[model samples]
Target: MAELPKSVSIREVGPRDGLQNEDPIPTEAKVRLLDALSRTGVRRIEAVSFVHPRAIPQMADADEVWQRAAKVDGVRYSALVPNSKGAQRALAAGFTEIEVVVSASDTHNRRNVNRGTDESLDDIAELIDLLHQAGATAEVIIATSFGCPYEGDVDPARVAAIVDRAVRDGADRVAFGDTTGMGTPRRVRGLITAVRDRDADIPVLLHFHNTRGTALANLLTALELGVTEFDASVGGLGGCPYAPGASGNLATEEAVHMLHDMGIDTDIDLDALIEVAELAEELTGRRLPSGVLRAGPRTRLTASSG
Candidate 1:
């Protein structure tokens, strides 16, 4: 087996990507969730998106939530934007790390932002320039990196070309999102290899959904390939609209548990994170699908059984 890194960084995306899919919760509740997550020793958090309210009603109160949430020391926060206007909102609100997303599938891109893939890339170049002028770092997230529900199988070269354009446009970092949880170990290797073939030095992040239960398996593959950064949600909170009744993103507590057992450090307090995951369930009024959250960590289980 290939050696895994001694330490990994998992950016918590529960507050932004997770809640944006559920019925709109009170701004206060969202603030509570963000504040709670901050205390869990999560080093990085994707806190909110600046999209139009009508586009994602659940994120309508993004500004208020960010203003009210506690900014913890040593924790880095980021916001996502869909366009130049949204980028302006994030920058004005004092966010230094901003993420912009465009889908690799043209149909997915059109459905998401009403623009073709290349057109979105063109816009992203300007957005990157806009962000850079403001002294903020721009990271481009390529959704549907593995496969697309609407387009079926997405070619690795197509995803690679998107990465190429984003890199040429001067993106500081890049992430591949398994938008519909369609990624597998094979697809993960293919996509990462394709992207590296284009730019071997660009920073890469992986975002996987647990829709088909391959998120962790895919993570392991990426680890072997030397990809360290990842995006995960607390309690497996977010579900893709395209794949109803399926599992959400990989659970942070579960991922932490597996990583810790492998002697890989995440710098997250697993017990504290699971508590926050439970808090997420309470605020959302629904049970999440995190096995580790429900069953406790391996050491905890072993101790109890003993």
Candidate 2:
């Protein structure tokens, strides 16, 4: 292993992405979980989503969650918005950072948003313009940047093109999602290099699903590519409904532990992150997919070596 980089940013998405996949947990419980995550030293948190309740019933109470969770100082809280209406509600709720997702795979795009690739791009551009007019930061989440389950193999060229379109639309940043957890280390490295080769100076983030047990390996590939921003769930509690057999998002505790072990300064307190991971499990009444959350980290011991 080499010397690790310091000062990486971990964006906590447990409240929005983590909970949206599960059966409805009360909004109060969601707020409490977000509140707990705020103190764990995460610089940013996706506290809520402003989508229609009909689309995602779990996130129907976005207003209440934002109202309660926004009070935490020193943390930049964001909301996921699907369109102009979603952006409108998010701004009205006093959120400054908003994220909109568009799929790179055409099949997944039509399935998720009922629109073709170009149509969704146009919609996202409009939402970006809306966010800009309202003095908010707009980010693009290019879901299924890896291989899509519905459409077997996703071309790196397609992923690069989607990123280019988003960058042209005035997005502040772009995060590529491994929605199905089907990405390998080679794919991760290749796609990242492809994006950079076409569009340099774009701040890119990685969102991973631990399905097929390759999420951590993909993270390592991104780290080698100098990607410091990542989206993670506290206890690895969210999976893609569109991708069958997909696991939850990469675990926050596992990422923190990996970073700390590599001497990377994530600004996250490991014990505090673990505590929040437990809360996520308790709140959802489901098991988290994080290894560190269960077996614990391999840390330096007080026992003397013989």
Candidate 3:
């Protein structure tokens, strides 16, 4: 087995990505969730997205949520933007770390943002400039990097080309998203290799959904490939509004438990994270699909029969 990195950074996207698919919660609840996540020792949090209210009603209160959040001392917060307008809104909300997303598959891109792949890339190039002008860093997230529900198979070379374009347009970092959880170990390796072959210096983050039960396997493969940054949600709460049949994101507490057992450090409090996951279940009024939440962590013990 390839040696794993000593430590990794897990960005919690529960408050934003996780809640966007559920029924709209109160702005106060969003603020409370952000505050709770900040206290869980999660260093990075994707707090909100500045999209139009009609598009994602759950995120309609993005401005109020950010204004009311208890920004912690050591935790870095970021927000997602769909276009130049969204970027401006995020900047106005005092966000220094902003993420913009474009899809690798044209069909998915069209369905996601009502634009073709090339059109979104063109917009992203301009959006990157807009973000930089406001003294904020821009990270481009490539959705459906592995495979697309609409397009079926997404070529790795196509994903590489998108990454190349985003990097050339001055994106500080790039994230590969398994938009419909269509990633396996082989697909993850191919996509990472393709991206690295194009640009080895750009920071890479992996966002996986457990829709097909391959999220953790893909994470392990990325780890072996030296990809250290990842995005996870508390209580496995997330699904793309545009992608039908897509499930929740990889569970944060479950990932932390596996990483800790492997001697890899994520600096996240597993117990505290589980508590937050439970809170998420309570808030959503549904049992989330998290293995660690259901079966307990690996350290849990039971009495043996004599």
Candidate 4:
């Protein structure tokens, strides 16, 4: 086993990524969900995505959700933006940490954002200037960085090149997304090395979906390389909009479970977070894929009452 880092920072993507793939929930309920997650000690939350309502009806109330979430103390709220208009909405919503997403594969990019990779980069450049001018940082999430369900077997070099372009366009950080759980431990280690080899200044984060049952293992590989930040959704609530049948993001509860078991502290309350996941299941009215939620954490035991 590789020597791992002492702690990892988890950025909750439940409200945005999680809800985006599901049927739209009431705006007030979304706010309540954020409020509950905030109290669970998740320091960074992707509160909302400022996308076109036509594009993602789940986030139609981005304005109201942002307005309500901006009031939380000591928690950093981020909004995912796709273009100049989304950035404007995020800025107006008072999100200090904004994330923009673009797929690494040309096919996925075109299908996802309706633009080629070049056009998406240009939009991100303009959006970064806008975000930075407002004293906020822009984080570019490179979607399908590992592999795409439609495109299949994305090149590591290609993923690195995308991150390089985003950095050149002034992204504060870049997150590699395993949209279809197509990443292996070797791939995880390779890409992390490749990106830092290109530019040591830009920090990297991982957004993983547990589609192929490899998300947890991949995360352990990243931990060995000193990756300290990640993206996970409560109740494992998310899926690739492009990868139609792929599973959702890695469960926040499961991530914390494995991390804590490995003696790496995440400072997250797993029980409390599981409760948050329960609320998510209730809100979405769907059964979640979270293992810890179904089996319960190891710390909890049933008493013998014979």
Best by TM-score: 1
Better of 1 and 4 by TM-score: 1
- Clashes by residue pair, model 2: none
| Candidate 3 ranges with C-alpha deviation above 4 Å | 240-246, 303-306
Q: What is the lDDT of candidate 4?
A: 0.87
- Root-mean-square deviation (CA) per prediction: 1.3, 2.3, 1.6, 1.5
- TM-score preference between candidates 2 and 4, better one: 4
The backbone clash count of each candidate, in order, is 0, 0, 0, 1
Worst 10 residues of 4 by lDDT: 239-248
What order do candidates take by lDDT, descending? Answer: 1, 3, 2, 4
Residue 147 in candidate 2, Cα distance off native in Å: 0.9
The TM-score measured for candidate 4 stands at 0.96
lDDT of 1 by residue, 1-306 (tens): 888899999999999999998778899999999999999888999999999998899998899999999999999999999989999999999999999999999999999878899999999999999999999999999999999899988999998888888989999999999999999999999999988998898899999999999999999999999999999999998876876777879999989999999999988999999999999999999888899989988777354563
Clash number for candidate 3: 0
Clashing residue pairs in candidate 4 are 238-248
What's the TM for model 1?
0.98
Error of 1 at 263 (Å): 0.7
Encode model 2's per-residue lDDT on 1-306: one tens digit a residue: 534457589999988998998779998898889889999989999988988999899999889877776466789999999888888999999888999998889998999889998899999998999899999999999988988888887999999998889999999999999888878999998899999999998899899888888888888888888888999998887866756445678898898898888778888889988988888889888877789888777873556887
Candidate 3: RMSD over Cα atoms?
1.6
**Given candidate 4, what's the lDDT at residue 56?**
85
Q: How many clashes does the backbone of model 4 have?
A: 1
Runs with alpha carbons beyond 4 Å of true place in candidate 1: 302-306
Question: In angstroms, how far off is 141's CA in candidate 3?
Answer: 0.4
In candidate 1, where is summed lDDT lowest over 10 consecutive residues? 297-306
* TM-score for each candidate, following the candidate numbering: 0.98, 0.95, 0.97, 0.96
